[model samples]
Target: MVNAFFLFILAGLAEIGGGYLVWLWLREARPLWYGILGGIILVLYGIIPTLQKFPNFGRTYAAYGGIFIFLAVIWGWGIDKKIPDTYDWIGVAVCMVGVSIMLWAPRH
Candidate 1:
């Protein structure tokens, strides 16, 4: 459980870094290498922690899908300096809540 949480944190950071790289690439074609490299690094970095933490790859990936959606919105607004409108906020909130349930709900 502890490992899982730690990896999740790392995954979040990796995603944020990856998103920033993509954003940069969009602005400056010259930085395409950085974006490509950063994406590969971020994905590889994230994979180790995820596999080490979760027994099932499917579950880990499923959780990531939700987390990524939420974080992507934050990355777009916070890092990219683009303000999200009301609908965007609402969608993020809804998805995050669902993610919370998916990750935390006890199965008996």
Candidate 2:
């Protein structure tokens, strides 16, 4: 559903953006505030998934893992200026298919 996908995207951005800020603080020598903000956002990332309607924690997180991978690739391409090759696209495609199957497939 639209809401589920939106939540997944929101959580993914929070995780990646928070981590990127921490990376900038430690690795790129940004200010301490960067790390502080990143930590806060990371906390938000942790809580966002709990908002999902899915009752199974493992299944929700597993499906989220695939979404995370897809978002990371896009983040790298756009923010890091790293263009993805054919292999990257292929891998993302595979992960997305796996995510769809895991999240939406019928159950007994």
Per-residue lDDT over 43-89 for candidate 1, one digit per residue giving the tens place of the 0 to 100 score? 76667555554566776767767667777777778877888899988
TM-score of each: 0.70, 0.99
Clashes of each: 0, 0
For each candidate, the alpha-carbon lDDT, in order, equals 0.72, 0.97
Per lDDT, the best of the predicted structures is 2
Clashing pairs in 1: none
Superposed on all Cα atoms, model 1 deviates from the true structure by an RMSD in Å of 2.9
**Where is model 2 poorest over a 10-residue stretch in terms of lDDT?**
1-10
Name the runs in model 2 displaced over 4 angstroms: none
